[model samples]
Target: MARFIVRAIFAALGLWLASRVVPGVRVDDTGSLILAAVLLGLVNAVVRPVVFLLTFPVTLLTLGLFLLVVNAAMIGLVALLLSGFHVDGLLAGIVAAIITGFTSWVAGMVIGDAKRD
Candidate 1:
């Protein structure tokens, strides 16, 4: 429970960074940013695996590059669900997704290392 909350916070941090780095991604406020992060985490947990399975063929054919599209779609879906979260287009979504993923990965690594020390 606490772990999940921590991860959500890290995810929110990633989204905040994305909003700063990506020109076409906008998060209206802190509340909306956190909500968007939680919603994104839920969508990724529940929906992403299914979508990944369904698109396995294309993903394989693309040598895993199509996962970026999958990530972008997930971000776009979050934007649709939350009025305060906006993704201007697929390109912007892709860029935002990449940035968020990178930031979140770094956060995870830092947190994981902290636990070990």
Candidate 2:
């Protein structure tokens, strides 16, 4: 639970960063940013795997590049579901995905899985 909260915070940070750097990715306020982060996490966890499975052939054909589209779609899905968080198009969503993914990667590195004490 604690770890989840931390990761969510990092995800919000990523979204904030994306809003600043990506032209079409707009997060209206801190509240929207936080909700979007949690929603994005849920979308990634639940929807991404199913979408990946469905697009496996295309993913293979594209030599893993299609994964970017998948990520963008997930971001776009969040935008569709959340009013205050908006992604203008596929390109902007893709950029937001990249920024968020990099932010999560660094966060994971810094907060590796902990062993039971």
Candidate 3:
């Protein structure tokens, strides 16, 4: 409920940061940015695990590097689904994914720590 919304906001902040820093990542507007965040969260939650499992062997072969590609694919998928969100190419998507994931992780840590205290 409230936690979900907070997570969504953090995700949106990540997306917004990605758009600012990643050259080929563009978020059309604030509303679209928020929608993209929510959709990205859903994509990560539902599709990521299946993709991770399917690619486990490759992931193992790559020594966990393939996980980055998986993350990029998730970002690319979100771009395909959202008109206002655009990732120019796989490389750009990968970079954007890294930025977004880092932001989300930091936010989660901060928020989670606050909750425990």
Assess candidate 1 and give its TM-score to the true structure: 0.90
What are the Cα lDDT values of the candidates?
Answer: 0.89, 0.93, 0.89
Number of backbone-clashing residue pairs for each candidate, in the order shown: 0, 0, 0
C-alpha RMSD by candidate, in order: 2.6, 1.7, 2.1
Clashing pairs in 1: none
Q: In model 3, what lDDT does residue 76 have?
A: 92
Evaluate residue 4 in candidate 2 and report its C-alpha lDDT on the 0 to 100 scale.
80
Instruction: Report the CA-based lDDT of candidate 2 relative to the real structure.
Output: 0.93
For model 3, which pairs clash?
none
lDDT of 3 by residue, 2-117 (tens): 66778789889988898998899999999899999899889999999999999999999999998889999999999999999999998898888898888888878867855576
Candidate order by lDDT, decreasing, is 2, 3, 1
User: After TM-score superposition, what is the CA distance of residue 42 in candidate 3 from its true location, in Å?
Assistant: 0.6
* Candidate 3 ranges with C-alpha deviation above 4 Å: 113-117
Model 2 ranges with Cα > 4 A deviation: 114-117
lDDT of 1: 0.89
- Over 1-113, each residue of candidate 2 has an lDDT whose tens digit, in order, gives 88788889999999999999999999888899999999999998899999999999999999999999999999999999999999999999899999999999888887886
lDDT, candidate 2, residue 67?
Answer: 94
Residues 17-110 of candidate 1: C-alpha lDDT, one tens digit per residue: 8889889999999899999999999999999999999999999999999999999999999999999999999999999888888877876776
